[model samples]
Target: MTEHTDDTDDTIEGHERELSAVREEHDDADDDVSLSLPGLSVDRRDFMKAGAAVGAATASAGCLDALSGGGSADQETASGGAKNHKVAPGELDDYYAFLSGGHSGEIRVMGVPSMRELLRIPVFTPEPASGYGYDDRTSEMLEEEGGGYSWGDTHHPRVSQTDNDYDGRWAFVNDKANGRMARIDLEYFETDAIVDIPNQQGTHGACCLLPDTKYVFGVGEFRVPMQNDGRDLDDPEAYTSTIAAINPETMNVEWEVEVDGNMDNGDGGKDGRWFFTTGYNSEHATTESGMTKADRDWVKAFDVPAIEAAVENGDYEEINGVPVVDGTRESSLNQSDRPIVRYVPTPKSPHGVSVTPDGDYAIASGKLDPTCTVIDVEKLAEADDPADAIVGRPRVGMGPLHTAYDGRGHAYTTLFIDSQVAKWDIEAAVEAEAGSEDPIVEKIDVHYNPGHLIASESYTADPEGDYLISLNKLSKDRFLNVGPLKPENDQLIYIGDDEEGMQLVKDKPSYAEPHDASIVSADKIEPADVYDPSDYDAEFVAEGDESIERIDDSTVHVKTYVKRNEYAFPEIRVQEGDEVRITASNVEETSDITHGMAIPEYDVDLALAPQDTREVTFTADEPGVYWVYCSYFCSALHLEMRSRLIVEPSE
Candidate 1:
């Protein structure tokens, strides 16, 4: 209807400007909204722009997303949960600090108290099969009748315990010897349930997480016949090893991973990282079927040809196609003394594993070598190849056995060959500058039998109180190679504060073969009161007299020398509402020794340094023969340093 004016270019330019203006306005609105959010109060526009800048900067700096030092999205999610719980930053620091030097020489460093070595309860005692008139019967029959037969005649199975949170009164014991896991009530110490897991023959090294998680992970049986046979590993039937996942709650086999090799011992971290050893390809003994003496001798003379024939005939195969070599047959086989497989070195019997308190990394002690390896847990979880997941090598001199890390970033490792415990300063290494040439390991030596050490963390009531509990499994006599089959004594060595440096507070005897331990709170049980000798009837004695004479009704002082380096407590009898006081002194020259006392019925623990004394007060409300013993780890006779307190009825 009107004259058409061709203004197409002008119209397009004008529309473009309008669109840009709208985008700017939207960005402003987004910024306003973002700036008003309570927790996320950053401007949206600014944040977007900053993100772009950061991306550009990171790209220019040649950084990968995975290798970036910043935390990942998963960490953000985990922190979000932590934040929602309103955990104070200071509290988190305190928690970590408590796990570090706080509980230095005890079983638990923080959180819930762990169980220390109270006593080792034997589940079986065998008599002579001939005397029992069972010589004609099989060993299995005799064991079956014995009621506690576990693993035929062997009883060196690893043991671990965990308390049930839901039932509160129940605890579980993973009895590797019996190929069974059993549940026992904590209050009564009685077995409630026992479940036998399949394919658990020759079970060792078992552990579990707490609460409702009823699963226990451990190493499975080794195919002894196949392993013992000397054959080429290229055959598929040469090895048979597996890792078992057992559901202790239901006593069922949940899952298993066939490793197809020898997995001797293993340990699991709290974060689900498991460390173990794998035997390398080696030759083993073999007995051929339908073969005469000549054939056997020929095969023994030339193993390679025999192995080839076996592989060709499909008569047998190496387990996992890996050879099993006997350590004793190297000279006959014309093999070098060095181990086989030079490049991809097999993990030869990895025994002990310990994770960092933060669950970021783990250290595994290699049984075949003197060095220990570190594993980056996050990288391992995401890695396509497990062999490549090991982070670094921290050479621990001699044969390393157990590794433990406190929250303060210090790692402790034990050397089995020399019974030495070495503490390494990991924090300094972690904080060192990137690509620095400084060495990371700092070693401090202590007395320990490296082959068997159960590392644990613990904390104390005093602010500076911290400890590390090392359950030394080998006794001095055994290490020295001189004693009557001394079953390795459990030594609880307390590494605590000493003016002469960090000295051992107690190195006392404990339950036999105390492999692993935990801690529990004194107040968790009934009888919240403490015990003191002052509130009880007093007695007096001459300097050298062992007998006591009752002097006062409430106070007792014994003049006899309590003996140096001894934990001695006087026997006391109290009624239901009576109080007790006891005093002790060390006549020895030791300056910093700590002698402590505990009444399990009343849950009282008291400690006094050498040449010093302390007192405790408690009401004997419970009627029982409560055993009072030294809480401190003392010397060889420490187990004998026990006295009984008799709580009687009040008239």
Candidate 2:
């Protein structure tokens, strides 16, 4: 109802251009006529205009129901839908879904069945609430890459796997914007390490898919020179990308395999013997037209153990301080004695590659086509011709992007153009001839443009077919009008074992955006509610013996302890222009009795969980008394928990 801003205007213009192109492609079909409403009549074109007016958001739910003619049926079946799967107040959910916070530079943990956001774990960005990036320990971790990077485009999140099932020991997320990968300690629910991936630009997809997470793997989505030190700027043919295998325990890049073209999202086999990724830019094109000119791209399969063996045998070249293996076709077909990579041709511009739960097949979605190519995982290494590896090409729907298995011989594919999810039988698809018999079992209309959808434990060896979360790209009129920008929608669909068809259960407003997520059963993860002081160094704990150690003329170290409503160091005095180091230890032994400290004028905040210790360093530049108080609620006397830092003027 309000005038569009400049950004909104640009967005509308872009959408208009896109719709115009769609109209031209369809020869300007006049099938979208006016619809008969209950009292008022609205044309389909006018309804689309309303969507465009709201910053080209997704269409209203009522509009989708009217178009699909299944609204009343959905309401009538509500009793048999997700109502049975609801988690009442004071009850716990059955699963933990870790969602990648796209562009927000974080990971969100949501409880399944309830769809409630339990916690937000900041990975690639600073979180002020938890004092993650501000604390001394986390700040040092962020400064590892020497760029002072603040934000990252997080894409895919994978929970560590053991024997192809959720291990729940660690969660890995990739920073697509900064070419970095982070590891979150599941027990502490905190980011423990961040490894800067060398010889890559955009780390779009990474996962700890092997058993016990032997090595975390990732691929560069963009191609660049091998060294990428200001060379081959104009030559597109000279550009290449890589897939890096990192040591999960050490959090270091052990080896990288150079590929010919840019790789997209990837998944590994259950045996940990092979990994597969979708490929594009195979023509080495610089322009969009040239990039999509080819009729088919590839689904590349890499021999994981073979590549590692090659690296072990001193057959890799060092680039950017990393051992780089030549996996490109130019190097493999001509120079290498044995092939370490196989490029199986698939439909144009594949986007997502997923391994089936049984580990027999790997499905690659065809983004530009209406099909998904299924390749045999074992045949990838033995097939003389790459074409022999592919077993099926099922025509799913318009703009199929990602596939999630139900562990019941069925696969659900997200249709971007159709705004729907199609369920198909995998074996039926493989047996039937292409375009002869429809392998699609059912199709459920999502809100709009669902980019990625994940079934409960879809990527693991044991997938539960209880529910599926559709990561819809837009929520347009789903909620109250916010502004020019609206939050994305994460729709919960009930695809339970006994259900006849998929039922739309609830629409949750997701933060900013989320690309992909992994749902693990609740029993798989057990995090610590209380911190253990013995795990940290003894020097970090104060043990109620508060003291100030003057290391040098301009340096001072103050050690303090905190309890329910008191501080060991009630007051600390320092001289102006002095470098001060303060160490605070929460001596509380109770679980969930966390403590925090904050200085009034200083940019310092510490989140001290029970029995947790933290340190902060700052320069005492102001010649005034600064009050430090507890930032986390502890007890009834929480407000009285305060200490004073007095800074005297330097002579």
Candidate 3:
């Protein structure tokens, strides 16, 4: 995926389905046959193999099967009338992928088995159709330092969990360019809150939540010279590469501590009683550089001190004061002055690290090295006296950037430079003899430069690792050239037991640059439908505001309600040159049934969550009819969820 800027037009808003080009590129598999054959349970590779034997007619029949990332449901066609009710849409793909929309500052929701784009949640960016930055309710959220920033370069998205498992309540994403994090309520599929990380200038590798979502960790990618200027990067203690741990409930930085090395970015952390981070670039130089052993690559751990523990110790007076918050309530919590943290060396350029499902080990990938390292989770947790915490290092392949675990004790590492993913037994490696050769169990070749490999993976106490999604950075010859910059490729790989093998199942194209993604089961989230006027709590509006009214002849106040596939509110009829104030309320409670209001050509778009009311003001300068419709794809009637604003000439 590529980095899009705030100035990008509305063209990037649509969910991608690069079907025609994918067909053109893989024409050799395009056989012509009757697609109405019996037994619709054919898998992805079965479609291709069947085409090879049954002629071109069969290839053309299952073309959509290839486009949809391969599964039993794909054969259903648009009418969705295929007799196979076993693996239909909303059945097999009970999991949803929340991916970073890169510089677009949006989060794309994709169904797992089908890879279908569900909804686009606007956060740090100004979406004209959703009226995110254009509307006052969300306008203030995008402001950087002071004033405001237009777009975001979003990087990591972490789903909140309970007891270290995906509970499906909310998802948190970070804006690398802006040093901020935002929360998305999964049930409503709407952005609920955003807060800035303190002491961090550049937010990168923010694998925020640990087990049970106790905290979201963040560190500066490029540490600014805090005390030393033009000096050696050797001063790891003085380096400004500080990692901030935020309280998920209050959105407060409960603790901040300087990492023990000079690093470019602290990739991500694995949670348990002890939290850990993997990173690169300690003792780095711009032009003059000599890499030391400790500076080469490293994995670190931080012990999250509870509020009770802080009080028990009675003011570690030398500690810095805790951070303050700015939201619905104004409260301050004390930041732990001295948090217990430790680290050990690893292969060069360790980027992504994760804890295994059974809480047995922590796995990290080295981007500059061929193999990956698996450290004992038990040893890491009990390392109070020891300085080094490494358990075993297994060589997998070239440039292993990240690792994903399947609940059945297998860890899959993505090899970026090698264009492959190395799967191995995590427990075996963790228990292997030191200095012994540990080889990977399986290596599946992928497209060029696979960045992140996501399974039904979560940073919760319990992990679900059934399937994998390879977010490949390049789509080189996979599709027709849109221009110079190519489309991204994401493939579905099944990690189930029994008959199905560990192979590529489905492949599809993602238009924008998607950096990282996280998945959650559909059952965990509860969305809303239909918002009523009585439940609205309006803090952003004038004192004692009513549902609907005419303030004066020049200005009118209108209240509107929205829900699934329809709107139950009145249309505004105002005179030309009159000031208009519209408050739109989304009355919804069903999971993921949010609504949007977009007045195209008028530069007005608003995102309304269930029982949420937001106001937007614009002048009815000319006499014309403006159409308002839902910007985000909610369901079958998204396009039909519309209303009209008729502007009459002053008479």
Candidate 4:
């Protein structure tokens, strides 16, 4: 560990006095501990020492695990008890799962291709009356304004699969507006539980340890109401920033620390001691007409408790006298500017945090700045001085956000400028430094405009060694139209390869507001998982055929009528590795809409024209139920024209 001189203006004498006072206050509070302030009894002196030890141990262990080429098995085991089944090695095909949020709400998932909706699990709500009007405008407005339908206001779902005790199933969605913590259950496809946390306002970014741990570490910003009214954004307080350890299961708060203000503070990197960033502060703004906008500011850091106390008391303010911007006046929080202190080439609105698995370097992206700042994580952890902590400067063109590293030392980041993804070689960075040359970061554009990138991973099946998945915020036009439509329909975007780049393979009138997605194992299926066709049985015969026949237990042959130019079918189910054959015959005039079936898991795509009877055979090796729809973006009832295929076990 290297020690750097404390570049901070605070003298050693002042720090010593503050430390002693904090220790004494902590000791006295221990004798009268209260349930409301759990984990508030530990002596500050001892806590800091213990924190250093834990931080060191965790960082070392993380580095060793990364070096060993350990896969997600360790993470899964750490998130909860080990399952009897292991994730099969390979890539799973991607598909979309629609979550019904009713009226105006967001549709969230894990990746772009496999958009599985994270539905709000029924929490024993009172049942509605038989004649209850679902179309009540007042009821819809209440849900929208009260955080029921606005997923964006409530959740900041970041990828946490690599943290010490984190499980892939637990996606952290912070309720920034209401200060609530939602642990989305991926296994059950619902929000299994909701934990109310104090000082949870502006719960921006969160991460967890692997497998079975109950706690998640998070950071949040604080705000004071304007004109004594809780709704107005006035008296913007900078010091109201904190980093907390929260128990997601019981909704218990462990501890929180306050970082320096004036520096925009949110997002952190956890290794041994949790390292965070801080920014500047601005005052709340009001127009001449009395309309107000919230304040905006820079980033900063803190140990934790100071932050919790500040949130409790509205007196907390940013340090260094950074001029405050009127929040009530600014359109976006990231747009405000404040003084940049400490680090060179100071970043504006620095938000997301990431560190190398080796504990060698740390990187953060400024929400407003186009460049990323890199620091020496290990040195910063051990340093007596902040100046000595900075490692190197590797500039990334365009605005950078959520970043991920392949255990092998390569880093991947997303640029929001053109919605392109970039790849970086960290090993090459080290070599460049050794040769006295700056490391060059490479960019591989995905051509998708992603608003907030969740995570990326290197897939074994891909030649580039990585497949990045990101969340695309709804376009402005799409966001304004969220709700039951004047006419019901869905929208679809088909992806296909082209000589120049990927092309819009097809378009459809079903599925809208698609977001984050995930890739799950496609190999797990059971015989019981299959669905019976009799559930939606319909009878129709071809122009020349008299009737339909069942070739086998799994196969069904249908006849079409000449009057019915196109036939609408019901959902089908099959087990993994089961062969499915759909034979269609056109009995009327040639139909313009091309008939095609897509098995997203198998990556099998086909296209058939009208008046042509064709049999498409495919093996559903994937386990989950997939929706099969016509590729052509045809008509008003396209939402109802889709069918489902439930893939089950092969036995």
- Candidate with maximal TM-score: 2
TM-score of each: 0.44, 0.90, 0.71, 0.45
Per-residue CA lDDT of candidate 1, range 161-250, in tens?
333212233334444454445443334232334445444445554545322344555554444434434654555444444444556665
Q: Tell me the tens digit of each residue's lDDT in model 4 across 1-651.
A: 322123211232243344234333333232211001111111222212222233112211111111122222223222122222212335343422222222222324422233323233321121122101121222232243233433334334432343442234545555554545555544433344454444445655454532233346555555333222354344444324444566666545555444333222234444434345444333322231121111223334232333333345442333222122222222132122321112222343455555555556666664444445566655554555444554443444345565655454556565554333444566554344321224433343221234433322221111122223444332222222455431121211111211111111111122433332223232211112222223212232355553345567655443332222234445565556655655544333444544444445654343333343434455666788787655544456544455567767666
Pick by TM-score: 2 or 4, better one? 2
lDDT of each: 0.37, 0.78, 0.60, 0.38
Candidate 2 residue-wise lDDT, 13-126, digit = tens? 454345334323423223211110011111233223343444233222212322234432334353334358678999999999999999988899999989999999998888
Candidate 3, 1-651: lDDT as tens digits: 132222121121110112122212322332222111111111223322332222111211212222224443223231123212124644656788888888788899888777888778888877765566777667766664312766777778888766666778888888788777788877567776777765566677666545567777665565544433465456543444556676777776675655544443333334435566765655543322333333245676555553225444552222335431210001122222333555556655578877776666777776655456676656655554322456666666555688887777677887665455777776676566532335456555455468888888644445576668888876554555598777888877666541233555566788778888888887887665644445345532322343556688788877666777766543567889888777766656664566788776666778776566787788888898887788778988778777788899887
Separate clash counts for every candidate = 56, 0, 42, 80
What does the lDDT read for residue 436 in candidate 2?
Answer: 24
**lDDT at residue 412 of model 4 (Cα atoms):** 56
Q: Native-vs-model 4 lDDT? A: 0.38
Ranking by TM-score: 2, 3, 4, 1
Off by over 4 Å in 3: 1-92, 144-147, 208-210, 226-238, 262-272, 287-295, 306-339, 381-387, 433-439, 498-501, 531-536, 539-556, 560-580, 586-602, 607-612, 618-651
Model 2 TM-score relative to the real fold: 0.90
